[model samples]
Target: MNVEDAPEGVEEPQILPLDAWHRARGGRMVPFAGYLMPVQYEGIMAEHLWTRESAGLFDVSHMGQLVFTHDGDIATVVRALESVLPGDVAGLGDGRMRYSLLLNEEGGILDDLMVTRRGSEIYMVVNGATKYDDIGHLLDALPDDVTMNLQDEQALLAVQGPKAVDALARLVPGVEALVFMTAGAFDWNGHALWISRSGYTGEDGFEVSIPAEAAAAFADALCAEPEVKPIGLGARDSLRLEAGLPLYGHDLDPETTPVMADLGFALSKRRREAADFAGAQRILAEREAGPAVKRVGLLVTGRQPVREGASVVAEDGAVIGRVTSGGFAPTLGAAIAMAYVPAELAAPGSGVRLVQRGKVHEATVAAMPFVPHRYVRASASPQTPSKAGA
Candidate 1:
């Protein structure tokens, strides 16, 4: 009797604010995230390469944006949220984004999302399709004192790629200074925009939430740039997969707990020791017992890519698990995928067999992110340099 297992029914398809803009640009519309969003504009492979080599614009208006505010201590407000999420929400610095999960009572993940502390409140952005249900869940779970508000007036746009900073810097001077996972409001083209120096693709980029009415103009203005071309859902999926990120329904769901999904790290040590969060006991027990099966990255040895739902077989021909997300990684120029394999066979450097086209394709359990992430980092390792001073 869970929400995800609710009786089969269909709701009328919805459209984003930029639906018209997408069609006018010759985008191929498809159903995704509960909206008739553009699946590809200039084709998937081309758009994927474009995002890596230059810049790509995406109308992520389908994503949900919300703002929350309450009286008194921020810790109290954050604690209420942290009780349900896996991340150390209480320790997040102002304007810093933290990736966490919304958990069910049994510690199963409902969604993964970003939370940014802004001033005396918190700003949150979640997947487009699950936002409404997520909001209601939060409302029902949170204490009465905690308040939540939907930022219905906003629309989201993401500008991502290697040249994302320079491409966006033209509008908001000094934007390049913002480090990864940091966000704040800035003026762009005479309109106030909330720009976050983070994105899904494995590159330096920004996700801007602007006024709904101005979203079209802002998107158009960015698209006018030489390097920025409109990308669609197909590219977005490929990019995130290449970055080793989990898609909602594919990599996460109510049936899979955070520990089983290998996302227990999102739960902070402080929270873990305190054991105050939702489904903490189950999540903690799973962590100790070691999940039977876990999500792992795969490096398919051949050109034939294993698509989702593809069965993974052990050396002895036993069905060990199944691939949850798979595709050709444009950046790596090879097929990559994520699968849930028995813990015994999930180690990196291990070899497995993937069945595609009813034929066995040799694959290795390579570490995630078949491609390297070029995030804007400072004072860390020899790699991952800052965009501004690099």
Candidate 2:
């Protein structure tokens, strides 16, 4: 989703704990997801390049932090979650996390989230704009024994890039030991923190979940490091796009299915065999027969950037598909985009035509991750491959 624009019908924007801190550092504040957030600090291009070369900090406190617990069987809680989400929650080991999609009864995606198994409690981070809707859906589907706690008092931050580990490990020792998609509990200056070795950028990074009251101090400490600087939502969007990650409410929505969105990897083999999750029948059938349209990457032929709402048209000028995400890729030094097109035209190297405001632009279908991913993983660990956009 575009971070600069707030959704329609939203109430007055709320202030985050770091509102003053951001403004003090010259952050350009804007309305986003019913909150006044910074869209840029130094600048989008400067911050985007800095994160790729060194380390950049991001304030993602707007995301929802949820914890699930049960006094009864933990297996019951797993079963309840599996009924709504397609991921293999039972197979997740302690401190392990998985990228999952919240699906409707028809198999349409309601929201995309990260679910981590932390001992007896299940921790989840959902998109800020749809957290309340997601909570309502889970409450209606979960068993009475399963309890969901929304951690509104927490603030989330992400430090990402080649040197992110070096900068963050200094504040909280032992965080460097965690591998990709793993998490652990730690303490810093008497405050509790739940940190995970994962992030939206396709670089080595860590996301810290800390107490909201101590957020400013923690942010200050992080930025004090020579290698780290505070980044904004603009660079975060470009980074995730270059990483070929989908943005919720933009690249994914209720009308989109996992198969159609090219996110079939989220469906574990064990769950696919059992065929027990929501929308199993339609999803499985689409997996076998193929989706009508597939999400693919596009390499524009010029320096001019393409924005959302552009159309993928046929030779005769009939609208065939639409662009979901598009922008100038700073890392690639060219323009790139993500769009849904006919399955026949989804192959890499296939030619396509794009039209925005009566101007036709030539583009070629290409593989995703316009930029290569640099996540750090242990060779001995049997963890599954890292999921895009997690």
Candidate 3:
């Protein structure tokens, strides 16, 4: 199931901290986001299901982790961030995190990210492919008082699935207290790490940011657990797809706004009321009057998986939209896809047609998250020993 990198002529991809570990474990390394990442292990199907039933460790070191500081105060920096981001940075409580988007001047999405409030410093994790662009934009958009620190020496690992807590608890105790969307600073093997109970799999999970040198050992520790297995990018994509979460370059881009992408929830209530963020005028207007087109889920009829760039047509064969992401959902055992189409035709059960590679297939508009989200709420009891303490 290993995926290899670029052909002979292309330059070799940059190696991550766990490159050796991945190679030793039969990972299929492929070029992604300027790095060589494991695309699959045993197979995409097995890895995807393993994550749903148990825990899967993923090396996401390619992502960019940033820390923001302000000389005046954290509040000042938070306000400055609000100028470009749509989330209420000032309202974020200690150790709490929120999913947000960086919007362009025209209300289009530049990138999607996870913002966590950590005492004096605000932490952010942006997509690897757009991290540089995002950093450049922030450098120009933020006020002089705010300082952005890019943490390139850190490696990220996601332990995700229903058994994630149990598997992770074996190594780090006291983390069970952290509920969904919450983060905390913890120690593992004498090394400090920031862990958040959030992930893209629509399941209970934790993402840990550790120093690059210690990443391999930390990943090995997590993988040693009986419930944990190393997963790859292939499963990662399928999992997010099943969760109906949009990928940046694919489902979302600079040309799509939050309203158009069906991500209005990311725009905090106060932010919407104030309408003070980037492209507020256009976003707020779209919220009230509605967007012309909307991102929607599609249930592809038959076995073929409709892929990106496929034309979405109306009943009369008029091109109305295009597919952005599509693939076979292991959990659902059916082919599913995402596309942007007219608002009127975005409703569930609406009839549509997908033309891919000259093959036209019938499809039906479906509600997102082809699978139900199983995020663990705060009510779950925390009980596990801390291996690090031992």
Among the numbered candidates, top lDDT falls to 2
* TM-score against truth, every candidate: 0.92, 0.95, 0.94
Name the lDDT value of residue 122 in candidate 1.
80
Model 3 root mean square deviation, Cα atoms = 6.3
Cα lDDT tens digits, model 1, 331-358, are 7889999999889888999988888667
Instruction: Rank candidates by lDDT, best first.
Output: 2, 3, 1
List, residue by residue over 1-390, the lDDT tens digit for candidate 3. 011121233345678999999989999999998789999989999999999999999999888888888763788878888888999888899998888999999999999998889998799999988887888788788887788888878899999988999989889998888888889999998999999988888877899999999998988888889999999999999998888999999999999999999999889999999888889999999999999999999999987899999999877889999999999999999999999999999899998889998889999999987887777657653332111100
Error of 3 at 291 (Å): 0.8
Worst 10 residues of 2 by lDDT: 1-10
Clashing pairs in 3: 2-28, 3-28
What's the CA RMSD of model 2 in angstroms? 4.0
Local distance difference test, candidate 3: 0.87
Clashes counted in candidate 3 amount to 2
Tens digits of per-residue lDDT for model 2, 1-390: 001122345478878889999999999999887679999999999999999999999999889888887874567778889989999999999899999999998999999999999888789999987887888788788877788888878999999998999999999999999988899999999999999999998988999999999999999999999999999999999999999999999999999999999999999999999999999999999999999999999999998887889999999999999999999999999999999999999999999999999999999999987887888787743223344658
